[model samples]
Target: MKVLVTGGAGYIGSHAVQRLLRDGHDVAVLDNLGRGHREAVEALRASSGKEIPLLEADLQDRAVIAARLRELGTEAIMNFAALAYVGESVTDPLRYYENNTAGVVSLLQAMQDAGVKRFVHSSTCATYGEPEVMPIREDTPQSPINPYGWSKLFVERVLADHAAAEPGFAYAALRYFNVAGSDPDAVIGEDHHPETHLIPVLLNTALGKRESATIFGLDYPTPDGTCIRDYIHVSDLIDAHVAVMNELDPDREDRRQMIFNLGTGKGLSVKQIIDAVKEVTGVDFPVEHGDRRPGDPPSLYADPRKIREQLGWSASITDATTMVRDAWKWFQENPSGYASQA
Candidate 1:
């Protein structure tokens, strides 16, 4: 199958693209290069000896997307495109809504016009907001506290409607937890500018890229006085995407819409992750404490048993030591990230 990845050059998107290709599918990536890097694609090309086709276009422009999809003869679309920052979304709600919510609508519209059917939508656990319990489920009531979660929920609603109305339009919206780790090859990795994610930030601070990482709301109800979360390896998450997208069918009843949670179904506190990083890298990174931010919960993890039992998909790599170690390996190799300056 020939697939189109909407945010193919970004961190998770690029990693997903690599997995799709490994699954014996032809792939073409559509990235605006706004927050994605071209060199990530180039690194794959260098390793595989195949140049991935990439388009420099945004999802807001539907015309260009339609043209690109038609030109590539794409069979399915895996959407990993969105602006995801909780604090920034709080200040700029409209920006998150426009790009994360409305942009998905445009992408779906283009797919509808192109006669494309299968879809693997990249969603987040943010839609679950501060989960009511430690292990969040798929059917839980969505009570998103911030614009970022609301924007994702809006897209999930749209996908549900499309699955009902259109024939042969099958979609699987995988709600991801804290996605960490890097490609085992060490060629491609997380390189978000003005980095916000914890694993990368800790690695950066260890490398002296930043001064210190702040532990927000450390005095929570957890045993370690911090929050714990379910961190999933990016590669394992991508494998699930490939497995679902390949199984999509248009004429099957009660099979068009599938939602799954991607994680190890366990929680790890902030201190545990920091300790793992220090254990892996042999660095004592400085840390500080800050006030609790809005829309943050004490602890949230996933019960990924459904995906494991049904799709034969479980997170095989459950080592935080490796998660931190592999990510630090990539950071060391690409000190300046894909820019080749470090």
Candidate 2:
């Protein structure tokens, strides 16, 4: 399959690029490099020994992207390009809509122009927005509390509508929970500017990159008085994407517009993640408990049975310790992330 991976320079997307190349698929990357690292893509090239093309352009650049898609003969698209900061989305709603929501519309338009039918959208569990249930399902009500969630949910809607109108179009929107860890080889790993994810933040503190890691809202109604979230390894998450991409046959009625929640069907509290980092890295960093952030649910995890039963795909690396170990391996080697390669 000739695949075009959007945001293929970022953490998850870069991992996808590596997996695709290893799976013997012809791959090209499309990233604006605004939030993604060119170094990550370069590392992928070095590791895979493939001169993978990296198209440095925005998703909203419809004409240029369409031309590139046609030139590359792209058969499918795996979109991971978006501004994903929840707090930042709250502060700047328009930017979220413009980039996260409007960007997909433009990409779909390009897909249409290029005659590409298959799409694997990178959705999120934030779209659920504090569901009353313990394990969220694909049919669960989507009531997003933030612009980031709404931005992604809106794209899902667009994909659904587009698929409905075009019978031959196929798409799979994988609503992911907390995606952590890195590639097992440590060739690439999670690196975000102004890092916010719990695992990376805790690992950074353990490495003495920061004074301490703060736990927001430790008075939640969980066993540890902190928010519990399902942490899926980056490699496992990309495996699900590859499975969906391979199964996206528009001729099959059930496979036209697929939606699945990706996770390990288990939840880990923030305190548990902190402990895992300390244990894995052998550093007990200072921990401060702060007031709970608004809109934070007590627990959010996926049922994951749908993907398991249908696609025979379930998370292999489910434990927080193993995730921390893989992540620690990368952090220990590259304390400065991809920038260390320079």
Candidate 3:
């Protein structure tokens, strides 16, 4: 399979590129190098010993993307290109819709031009939006609270509608929870400007990169009075993407849209994650409690049985400690992240 991974220079996309190459798939990267790091793509080339093509272009450039897709003979696409900050989305909702939602529209146009049918979309649990249910499922009603979630949900609808209308088109939208940790080998990992994810923030505090880590909402109605979220390892998340991509057969008569929730079916509170980071890094970092961020649910996890039964895939690294340890290893190796290489 020849796969074109959009945003392959970013954290999770880069990991997906690595996994695809490891699994014997010819891979090419299409990243704008906006939020993604070029050094990460270079590192992947060095590690894999393959001259992977990095198509430095945005999804909005439909003509260029379509030309490249045709030239490379791309069989499938794994989309990870989007602006993914909740707070930022609140302030600038239009940007989220333009980049996350409208960007996919252009990409789909290119896919149509190239006659590519299989797509693995990087969806999110935010589409579920503060559900009353404990374990969210594929059938869960989607009522997104923020523009970020709405942006992704819009794409899910686009994929579904496109698949329904177009014959031989198939897509799998994996709505996943909190994606944590790094590659086990520490080759390429998470590094976002103004980093927002919890695991990296905790690890940075432990590394003395920051003075302290702030725990938002210590009064949530939970065991630790904090919000709980499912943290899936980056590797495991990529594994599910590969499984779905491999399973997508456009020639099959029954091929259509597939939606699955990716998680460990386990929830970890902020307090538990903090403890795990402390134990993993052996650093007692300063911790501060703050009021809850708006729209934050007390608990959010996934009912991963559907994906498990269908794809025979489950999170291999379910322990918070192990997730923290892999992330800690990456932070230790690249304290400044890929910036130094740049």
Best by lDDT: 2
Question: Model 1, 1-342: lDDT tens per residue?
Answer: 999998999999999888877777788999889899998888887777767899888888888888888898999999998898888899999999999999999999999888888889989898887767768888877888889999999999999998878877899999999999999889799998889999999998999988998889888889998988899998888988988887777778656888999999888899999999989989988899999877578889998988888889999878789888879889998888888732
lDDT of 2 by residue, 1-342 (tens): 999999999999999999999999999999999999999999999999999999999889999999999999999999999999999999999999999999999999999999999999999999999899979999999999999999999999999999999998999999999999988899998899989889888988988889988999978889989999999999999999999999999888988988999999999999889888888888978998899887888898899999999999999998999999999899888999888988
Off-target runs (Cα >4 Å) in candidate 3 are none
Candidate 3 C-alpha lDDT tens digits along 273-328: 99999999999999998888878889999999998998899999888999999988
**All candidates' lDDT scores?**
0.88, 0.94, 0.92
TM-scores for every candidate against the unseen true structure? 0.97, 0.98, 0.98
| Pairs in clash, predicted candidate 3 | none
Question: lDDT of model 3 at residue 27?
Answer: 97
